[model samples]
Structures are given as C-alpha cells and as structure tokens.
Target: MVIRAEDVRRSYGETVALDGVSFSVEAGEVFALIGPNGAGKTTLIRALTGTTDAEGTVELFGAPPTDVARHRIGLLPQEFSPAGRLTARELVAYYAGLYDESRDVDAVLSDVGLEDSAGTWYENLSGGQKRRACVGTALVNDPELLVLDEPTTGIDPTGRRDLWRLVERLADGGTTVLLTTHYMEEAEELADRVGLLADGRLVTLGSPGELVARHGGDSRLVVEAEDEMAASRALESAGYDLLPDERHVAVPVGPEEIPAVVEMLEAADVEYGGLVWRQPSLDDVYVALTGTDVTAGGDPIEGGRP
Candidate 1:
C-alpha cells in the first residue's frame, strides 16, 4: 500500500472529527475520499500528513510518515495561500528545495499549464491560475504519492479538464494518489476506487460502476402527476416506494410494472407532465445510502469543502 490508515480517530473538544476510519491506497491507483462538510475528510488528511494529533496507525511507503516519507508525498492542501510577494517560479522553486530529488522546476510548471505565468506574483494571478500554481508546487518534487484536497475548486471548465488529464497522467506513470473532492463528476472521471465518508465514518467504498450497481438497483419510473399527493397515496397503496419531488413522483418498479403504473395514472386521471426511465447513477447511490439529494446540497460526507 502506498498509504494506509488503521483505526484512525480524532476529536476537537466535544465533537468527534474522525471515528475509527480505516482505508488504504494501492500504488499507482487513484483513491478519492468523498463526503460532505464536517465529514472529517480534512481531519483525516491532516492526520495522515502528521499535521494533527490523532490515534491511529498510519504508514506511507511501508514506514511511518517521517521527514523522508514526507519528501516522497506531495500534498495539495484544501486551504493554500502562497506568499503574496513571491512570483510563481520562486514559490515552486522554494518547494522543490524541500525534496531530496526534485523534478525540473520549468517542467513542473509546464505540466500544470502555468509556464506562462511563471513570472507573475502569486497574489496577482487569477483564482484558477493560483490553483494551478498550487498543484505545480505539489508536483515539483515528483513524489510517488500525491495527496490532494479539492485541488480543482474555483477552476474554469477548461482548467478543470486539464487538471483531470494531469491526474490521469500521474496515475498512469505509477504515482499513487489520494484525493478528496465534492464533485462527483471529478471523482468518477479520475478515481479507480472511491471511499464515501459520512459523519466521520466510511459509508461505502468501490469503483464508480460498482457503487452504482451495488447501491442503486434498476432504473426508476418518473411520473409528473397533476395531483402529486393523490399519486403518492396511490403508489403507497400499491406497495411501491414513492420518492416525491416538487415536479414529479418517482417510484422504483421493475419493467413489468411499467404498464400497471401507466394504467393506474390513467385510471386516477393524474395528469403527468413527463416521464423518464434511465439507469441508476452515483446520485441514486448517494440518495439510497444518505437519504439526501446528492445533486442539490452536495455530498454530506465531504463536509462541503469544495
């Protein structure tokens, strides 16, 4: 394992930040830590990096996270602020000096698409530019393990796509990465395995497709009825689990039950606005497990960091 944590726990006064969390990251794989605000993603990251005190067994590259191990790990923290007076090139070079063996500073800058802004002062760059610079700093050491916390937040669509490509390239080159983000699309795009944390606990962990298959079953039947209350009552009477929304009522039903649903709607004269049948997605898996809208308020597990 490139990164390992066993029985990790932490607390701040009365609130428990992490509760016996355990997970591992295999070499050359992209592992994503996903959750909502206050889910302890940051807390766990801090513990793993040895930036905070906690009770756990943590190892990086087969040993404790000592100075040598720290040199082999690239960490892009969630809240990063560069010195306002330092130019991008200077900032990256300063970080490069921390590692025993560092990559070419120019190559690192170009890798993150920040070569053009090399001379720009850190505080003068745009938000996206600043984020890219931060990523560049992390990559300067060419570490074997990359630990990124919301690395793409505030980036434009183009920048976000570029960052995803960079992550893929890193993984393909045998670099193990442990990342945390609130964006499901980002997780789906880059992760080989995702660990969902909720309320400081691991709720689920699997590949994107595997998670959907395990937690989100078949497609749902969406019905927009004129009278949602009556339709919900009818669905309950029929023993179907009705998921209500302001615009429509969704029910889980097998393919054979589709005809019956249409008939019931017609008989009850419930005028539906539209209907859609589609395969389950990660959002469905989240709703099924967390009992909340993943698309609306975001994943509660990561604690709304991104």
Candidate 2:
C-alpha cells in the first residue's frame, strides 16, 4: 500500500475533526476523497502529511511518514500562495533546494505547460497559470506520491481538461495520487476508487461505478412538458415511477420499460418539449450516502447552498 491509515482520529477541543476514519491507497492508483466543507477531508490530509497531530496508524511509502518519507511525497495544498516576487522558475528552484537535489526546472515547468511562463512572476500569473506553477513546484522533486486538494477549483473547462490529462499521464507512469474534490465529475473521471467522507467519518468506499451501482439502481427519465402534471399523472397511472422532484417529472424505469413509457406518453398526447435519460453517477452516490449535495458544503440537502 502506498498509504495505510487506520482508525485515524483528530479533535480540537469540543469539535471532532476526524472520527476514527480508515482507508488505504494502493501504489499507482488514483483515489479520490470527496466530502462537503468542514467534513474533515482537509484534516485527514493534514494528518497524513505529518503536519498536524492525530491519533492513528498512518503510514506512507510503507513506513511512517517521517522526514524520509515526507521527501517522497509532493503536495498541492488547497490554499497555495507562492511568493509574489518570485518567478515560476525561482519557485520550483527554491523547492528543489529543500530536497537537497538538482532537477530540470525547465522540464518540470514544461510538464505542467508552464515553460513559456517560466519567467512570469508568480503573483502576476492568471489563476490557471498560477495553479500550473504550483503543480510544477510539486513535481520538481519527482516524488512517488502526489496529493492534490481541489486542484482545479477555479480553472475553466479547457484548462481543467488539460490538468486532468496531466494527472492521468502521471498516474500512468506509476505515480500514486490522493485527491479531495467537490466536483463529483472529476472523481468519476479520474479515480479508480473513491471514498466518501462525512462529519469526520468514512461513509463508504468503492470504485466509482460500484458506488453508483450500489446506490442508484434505477434509470431516470426526465420529460420537459408544458403540462407536467398531466404527463406525470399519465405515467403514474401507467405504473411508471415518479422520482423526487416537481419542476419536471422524472420517471424511474428499467431499460425494457423505457420504450413503453415513451409510447404511453405519445399515445396520451402529453406534450413534452424533450425527454432525456440520465444514468446513475457519482453525484447520485454522494447524495444517496450523505443525504446532501457535494456542493451543499455539509448543509442539509434542502438548505440552499451558499
């Protein structure tokens, strides 16, 4: 195992940040930890990096994450702010000195698509470019494990895809990664396995598809109709199921029942603008297990997100 954490617990006075959480990460695997804000995801990451006090059996690189093991790990913290005055190259070079080693600063910069911005001052870079620079700093040491916390939070879709590709390429080359994200799509797209955390506990753990399958068994058919009530009643009368929403009626149907539901809608002359079938996803899994949306930031699902 690249990471082995068992019964980990952390507390701050009256508040328990991590409550006997346990999980493991295999070498060369991309494992994602997802939870709402204040769910102790950051607390666990801090403990694993040996930056905070905690009670647990935690190991990295098959040993305690001491000075030696720490050197083999690269971290892109959620709140990263490089020195405003330093150029990208200077930032990476400074980190290289910490490892007491020399690295191809240019290569690391280029790997993260930052070669052209090597001379740009860290504070002047765009949000995505700054993120890229931070990533370069993390990679200069060529560590065995990479830990990222919300690595692409503010990046645009195209830049986000580029970063995703880079992370995937790194894993393909035998680097183990552990990440925390609010974006369920990122977890579904990049993770071989995902662990859902809530209120300092490991709620569930499994492959993305397995979690989705375990939590969501029915396909959802969403219809947009001018008269949603009549359409809903027609489907309900025909024994089609209604999901838990009112803006647009969603019917729960199996593969074989899909055609039947469509035909029934047509025959009943229920005017629908469009119909779409949505498969189960990690978003569904999270909502099912936590009873709240990932973007809800630990609030009850009905409490509107801020």
Candidate 3:
C-alpha cells in the first residue's frame, strides 16, 4: 500500500475537523477524496502528509510520513502563496533545487502546459496559469507519491482536461496519486477509487462505478411537464417505477423502455415539455450520500436532499 490510515481523528478546538477517517491507497492507483466545504479533507491530507498532528496511524510506504524521505513525496496544498515577484520558472526551479535529484525545469513547465508562461511573474499570471505553476512546483521533485488538494479549481475546461491527462500519464508511470476535488467528473475520470467525506467522516469508499451502482438509484427518465402530479400519476398507473421529486416527475426505466414510456404518455394524452434520460453518475451518488445536490461542475446546491 502506498498509503494506509486507520481510525485517524483530528479536531480544532470546538470544531471536529476529522472524525475517525480511515482508508488506503495502493501503488500506482489514483485515489480521490471528495466532499463539501468544511468536510475535513484538508485536515486528512495534512495528517497523511505529517504537516499536522492527529490521532491514529498513517503510513506512507510502511513508514510514518515524517520518517519517509521528503524527496519521495510531493504535496500541493489547497492554498499556496509562493513569492509573487518570482516568475513561474523561478518558482518551479526553487522547489526543484530543494531535492538532490529533480526533473529538468523546462520539462516540468511543459508538462504543466506553462512553458510559454515560464517568464511570467506569479502575480501577473491568470488564475488558471497560477494554478498550473503551483502544480509544476509539486511535479518538479518527481516524487513517487503525489497529493493534490483541489488542483483544478481555477483552471478552464481545456486546462482541466490537460491536467487530467497529465495525471493519467503520471499514474501510468507508477506514481501514486491522492487528490481532493469538488469536481465529480474529475474523480469519476481519474480515480481508481473514491472516498467521500462529509461532516468529517468517511461516508463511502469504492470505485466510481461501484458507488454509482450501489447508491446512484437507477437510470431515470425525467418528464418535464407543466402538471407534474398528472404526469406522475399517469406513469405510476402504467406500472412504471416512479422516483419521487418536487419538480419533474422521474421514472426508473431502462434505455430500451424509453420508447414504451413515450407511447404510454401519448396514449394517456399526458402533456410534457420534454423527456430526458439520465444515467446514474457520481453526481447522483454524492447527492444520495450527502443529502445535497451538486451541479455538474460540483457546486453544491444547499437544499434538502431529495
């Protein structure tokens, strides 16, 4: 195991930042931690990296984080403030100089898609560019284990996909990755396994597909109608399994059953604005487990759970 944590606990005065969290990450596997704000993700990262003290055991390569060689690990905190006056190259090179052996500075910049912006001052770079620079700093050391906390927060869609490819390449090359992101798609795309944290607890842990299968409910056919009650009654009467909702009436149906549903609706003369087919995804699992709904981009909508 590249990482092993058992019953890890941490608190800050009145707030319980982490409540008995535990999980493991294997070598060359990409593991993602996902949850809402104040979900103790940063605390767990800190504990695993030995930057903060907490209860329970956390081992990296069978050794305590502090006992492990620093050159073997790379960490990018959620909030990093390198020297603003330093250019991107200078920032990455400064970190590279800390290790006895490191990847070439130019190569690191190119890997992060920042080669053209190498001379740009840290403060002058765009939001996405600054984030890329920080990622470059973490990669310059060429560590075996890489931990990234919200790595793509400020990146554009194209930049985010580029970073995802970079992560995929790193994992293919035998680097163990532990990342935390609000982006559900990021976790679904890159993670071999995902651990969900809420209120400082590990709510669920599994592969994305497994979680979606277990908690994502079912494949839903949503009928957007002006009269939801009538549409819901029509579907329920037709022997379709209905998923309760406040707005659109949703029916659990297989893809092949969609035409049958449409036929039934037409026979019953039901009026619907449109019909949408949605497959179970990590986003649905998040809502099912956390009692909150999140947008595709991972912004939480603060409402009662469905």
Candidate 4:
C-alpha cells in the first residue's frame, strides 16, 4: 500500500475532527475522500502529510509519515496560493530544489499542461492556470503518492476537465493519487475507490459501483412540476416515492418502469417542465449514507479549517 491510516483521531479542544478513521490505498490506485465542507477532509489530509499531529498510525510507503517520506509524497494543499513573485517555471524549479531526486522543471510543467504558461507570473495566471501551476509544483518531485485537496475548487468546466485529464494520465503512469473534493463528478471521474466521510466518520467505503449498488436505487425520475402540492399528491398516490425536497421528485424505477411513471403523471395531468431519467451516482450514494443533502447542514469543527 502507498498510504495507510489506522484508527486515526484528531481533536481540537472539545471538537473532534476525525473519529477513529482507517483506510488504505494501493500502489497506482486513485482514491477519493469526499464529505461536506467542514467534515474533516482537510484535517485528514493534514494528518496523512505529517503537517498535523493526530493520535493514530499513518504510514506512507510502509514507513511512518515524517520528513523522510515527505519528498516521496507530493501535496497540492487546500490552501495553495503560489508566490506571486515567481513565474511558473521559477516556481516549479523552486519546488524541485526541495527534493533530492526531482524531475526536470520543464518536464513537470509540460506534464501538467503548463508549458505555455511557464513564463507567466504566478499572480497573473488565471484561477485554473494557477491551479495547474500548483499541480506542476506537486509533480516536480515525481512523487510516488500525490495528495490533492479540492484541486479544482474554483475552476471552470473546461479547465476542470483539463486538470482531470492530467490526473488520469498521472494515475495511469503508476502514481497513487488521494484527493478530497465536494464535486461528486470529479470523484466519479477519477476515483478507483471512494470513502464517504460524514461528521468525523467514514460512513461508506467502496468502489463507486459498489457503493451505488449497495445504497443507490435504480433509475431516478426527476420532474419539475408546475404545482408542487398537486404533483406530490399525484405521484405518492401512484406509488412513486418523493424526496424530502419536492421541487424535484425522485422515483426509483427501471427503464421499463419509466413509462409506467409517465403514464401516471399524464393521467393526473401533472404539468411538469420536464422529466429526466438518469442512472444512480455518487451524489445519490452520499445523500443515502448521510441522511441529509450533501451540501446542507455543515459547520466547521472548532479550530478546524473550512
């Protein structure tokens, strides 16, 4: 395994960040740690990288997480702000200097799709470009393990896709990647396995398909109704389940059952904007495990970074 955590726990005064969390990552595997905004994802990353002292055992490449292993595992931190004074090339060169065995700075930049921006000043780069530059620095050491926290937090769709392709290529070339992000699609895209964290606990752990199969239902029916109240009455009467938030009613059905649902809705004259049919995903899995909307009801633990 490239990374391992056993019974990891972190506390700040009375606040508990991680509660006996344990997981492991294999060589060349892409794993994701996903949770709400303040559910201790960042804290866990800190512990794995040896930036924070938590009570538990964490190993990087079969050794304790310490300065000796720091050079072998790269980090693109949650609060990554590049030094404005340095250009892209200069910044990567600076990161390369930190490791005894480092890849060429230019090669690192090229690997992250930043070769054209090598001369661009850090402060002058766009948000996505800056993120790519940060990734370049993380890749400079060609570390065995890459830890990325919210790597595409504020990036546009195109830029986010570009970065994802970079990460995919890295993982395909035999680098182990561990990341945390609120974007479920990103996890769906890159994670070979996912661990869902909620309120300082690992609620679910499995491959996307496994989790979805275990917790997720069949095809979901999403209808935007003209009248929420009437729509609820009609759907519930016809044996379709409604989510707590009725703005969009979700029903579990197979492809053949879709027509049955549409038949009922049409019979009731339910005026809907549209009906969308889609497969179960990580979003549904998270909501099922947490019993709350993934984006709702989260306050940071005391002394915890958001």
TM-score of each: 0.83, 0.91, 0.92, 0.92
State how far residue 36 of model 1 sits from its true place (Å): 0.7
Off by over 4 Å in 2: 245-247, 254-260, 298-306
Q: Across residues 1-306, which tens digit of lDDT does each residue of candidate 3 receive? A: 999999999877666778999999999999999987667788889899998899999999999999999999999998888999999999999999999999999999999999999999999999999999999999998999999999998999999999999999999999999999889999999999999888788999999999999998989899998788788889989998778642688988888999999999989888999999999888788888888754322212111111
Candidate 3: minimum summed lDDT over ten consecutive residues — where? Answer: 297-306
Per-residue lDDT of model 4, residues 1-306, tens digit only: 888999999987787889999999999999999888768898999899888899989988888788455677889887777789899999999989987889998888887778898999999998888988898888888888999998997788988998899899989999999999888899999999999998878998999889999887666777788886787899899877776643577766666777888788899998888888788888888888788766765655523443
Residue 209 in candidate 2, Cα distance off native in Å: 1.2
Stretches off by above 4 angstroms in model 4 are: 236-246, 297-306
Name the candidate that leads on lDDT: 3
Residues 209-248, candidate 2: write the lDDT tens digits.
8998899556788889889889989988998778883358
Superposition TM-score, candidate 3 onto the true structure: 0.92
The C-alpha stretches of model 1 lying farther than 4 A from their native spots are 221-247, 251-277, 293-306
Q: Rank the candidates by lDDT, best first.
A: 3, 4, 2, 1
In terms of lDDT, model 2 sits at 0.84
Steric clashes per prediction:
10, 0, 0, 0
lDDT (Cα atoms) of all candidates against the true structure: 0.83, 0.84, 0.89, 0.85
